[model samples]
Target: MKQLFVLATALLLAVSCSQNKAPKTLVLYYSQTNTTKAVAEEIANALGADLEAILPVVPYDGDMGATAARCAKDAAEGKLPELKPFTVDVAAYDVIFLGYPIWMGTYAPPVAAALEAVNLDGKKVVPFCTFGSGGLDTSVKDLQAKLPNTEILPGYGVRTARIDAAKAEVDYFLKSNGFLAGEVTPLPDFSEVRPATEADAAIFDAAVGTYPMIHAAATEVASRAVPGGIEYLFTAKDLPRDPAVEIPDHFIKVYVLAEDGKEPVFTQVLR
Candidate 1:
């Protein structure tokens, strides 16, 4: 009877331990315009994980041109904006979904600050970003460099214009990575995207040389018209010779606008 009682007590303890296991997943993000926040919320809901935002001590001005200028200044100085105290306990989560907006071809400064705050050693860090025209490869490499001790996964990137259509892509990303289990919603056919025309190529070619970091020679891959401007995806060669910075060899997204007979200006560049 004594031995049987001891065995039962051990079994109960094992069950209790299993039930008291800590949550292994969390979604952490910093968003300026709510684009990254929308995607992060979807991911958190799908994975049933906890959600936390990195609040900056000084919030960004909502104006795009102003924000871009500020980001450029900070990037050139290699300075990260100060972030408010993070709410999540870094030690409690084993998997971190790090999401942010791509600012000047990299993670926003607040994300840089957040990376410094957390000890992500031994954690699996998955990144996702919202960009105007930039891809995920550059930002993923940057994140890996910052969190050398963590396992960084190949991330997901969505154009800010396509956030409404991101449900299927987000679902597939989570399931393929083993973060979620279940049926994935099918994506709508985007076959209607118009191809780049000769005129579009000319416009892109004329604007590419005007930018500093962009190469003069470019091949227009795709073009689409948005509300106020035309968006061009270009494969650029011989990028600006900057040894101190890491630039990815990939398609750069450029937006051009010419209104009221004004000279067409390259409004945005996503490298």
Candidate 2:
């Protein structure tokens, strides 16, 4: 009789503990041009999570060229911008949704400095970012390396040009990751790659032509159907800007979305 009572009490306590606790989430981000801030706010609103921005002691302002030069000088000196001290108790959060804008190829200097200041050990980290082209995968890898004990999950990234898509995309991202309650259709896999046809090349040209950084031509392509239309995965060969330079040509993977009744756009590029 005593054993039965003890077992019942233990089970009751276990049930109470399990049912009463919810993981606390915080949306922490640093935005240069407010693009990342928009994403951070959307996430916080959706999750009802705490929101905070990581600010640098010296704000990165001025023209793009000037900012780039300053960043470069800092990088060459191995210097990280001093971050303004965080007001929130970072240790209290169970899950941190870390967001940033990609600078050169990873999280901007302020984020790098924030990582140095905050100890995120044993916490679950979800990465999100805005970029000119693409850098989420690389930044996530960097975070994993820096915080070996932290659980880094799959991340969401959007191009600066596609900031307008963040709302619908963030909703889908949260739902798909089980962070929010909703149903999302799983995206289909791309079909096997084949040589690009004239139409495929035309679509690729129209998508990448505006980007000053890309001077490549599509060689092969594969595609799958998305919700609104189709998504293409193009294997492109970089065209030499200077024939006399004698640099070896390499391949890059580009993702382009052809939505219904709209011009196709390159969603992300994997170099």
Candidate 3:
């Protein structure tokens, strides 16, 4: 019965190999000013996942005003900028960490193009974003709506002001989500933030009617600086809050170009 024994041993080895195969993961992202890229790198390193950046065929201008104007036009028109050739076997990866900087309450346009390029019908999608005062909940919902066939995990967001503590935040997120087995680190705290001042109100007022996306009148609540611009967080005075939602102070972020001589031309509006 030596042949029978050999066959059984081979079958057991095959089963063991199948069971022990490492889960393949990919970290795909599009970063405008390296903020999202930094977060993506941290997640990729923690999970030992392959990393890929989505590059647009035409590089955006370094001037914050110019880039903002272009992005606004493209986004309004539903035009996806042509992307540089990025080939990834999407089906091979069991998990994909999709990252982007928040643009107008949604993921960047390049992210939209990337998601449309691949068929992730059965894969797990974990979305993460970099923002000023904006939260990740809205963007995660947008992604879920776009790829309803895929499973989306709870996402993570990092404010540019808190980039120094991203590793800790990412660690906590990973451990909490059962993606890692290790000691959890404390999440970043921004509770000591000061209230918005009259200067902040003036900035919002100056750019009120500049962009189509931003409401004509708003009450400035907070503000923060991103890489290429400053985001003025505000709440519409006319809009009623949904009592069903727990977040009472939910604010929208209006991005303005950071360069001098710019009349605070509004670029992006994000919730």
Candidate 4:
């Protein structure tokens, strides 16, 4: 009887241990100018996960133009900067939250280096980024191509101009995605796309006109109601602008948020 009792207790303990084992998460990021670092730290804190920075052996610390030039040159030469040895055993973690700032419409070169050095096979990777305009979709595509074995989960991104909104957005994002323990009222679907009215065009212009990189004319718009205001999705044609500032894409979609009693500002641009 005593032996049977001991076996039952062992089984109970095993069940308890299995129930308590949480999936481990690590936030690995490479940040230039600290925008992406802030987002990484926020996710790490909110999730209570481990955080580590991916560093390049030769830093890109030059002025904006010089750094961009260097990045272009290195990319053209098919060179990836050497990465510092990662202290964390990546295989030990079940999930990796990869973060970086968008440069040249994709993940920074240092992050590219890190991906080459670390093998995250079969792990769930959540990408989070900070960008000047938008590169989340493009970088995620690149990541999918690079790490075909890893499960690439849907990611979160915040514009550099709207970094202040990231805290609340991240919280909502975590809860909405089932990453955190909370209830979120899911946002309603956007209204169907229709021709942009004069007023809609005005809002679109107000939102994106000041931005130097984007020279677009809104052709169609769709709106949805949010807690504080209306969110617009604009299907825009790439305006004929100076070839210097134009991107190769002909059509782009822009998301604009017009909060109550505030001016409209663009959130993200999808090309």
Winner by lDDT: 2
Best candidate, TM-score-wise?
2
lDDT of each: 0.75, 0.93, 0.75, 0.92
**Alpha carbon lDDT at 61, candidate 1:** 68
Writing each residue's lDDT as its tens digit, candidate 4 over 123-219 gives: 9999999998999999999999999999999999999999999999999988998889999999999999999999999999999967988888899
lDDT by residue for model 3 (1-271), tens: 9999999999999999999997799999999999999999999999988999999999774566787788888878988889887777767899999999877667878899988788889899999988754547788888889998999998888766558768976988899888889865443332233455677667666765434344334554545554344555454443334446454344565544333555554434455
Stronger candidate by TM-score (2 vs 3): 2
Candidates sorted on TM-score, descending? 2, 4, 3, 1
Query: How high is each candidate's TM-score?
Result: 0.65, 0.95, 0.66, 0.93
Stretches off by above 4 angstroms in model 2 are 2-7, 243-245
Clashing pairs in 3: 105-270
Across 1-271, the per-residue lDDT of candidate 1 in tens digits comes to 9999999999999999999986489999999989999999999999889999999888996697999888888879988889888787977898889999987778988988988888899988889999876657788888878888899987887877668757877988888766777765443322243455677567666765454455644544555554344444554444546667766665555555443444554545555
| Alpha carbon lDDT at 183, candidate 4 | 94
Better of 1 and 3 by TM-score: 3
Looking at model 1, how many pairs of residues clash?
Answer: 0
Backbone clash count for every predicted candidate, in the order shown? 0, 0, 1, 0
TM-score of 2: 0.95
Give the true-structure RMSD of model 1.
Answer: 8.7
TM-score, cand. 3 vs. native = 0.66
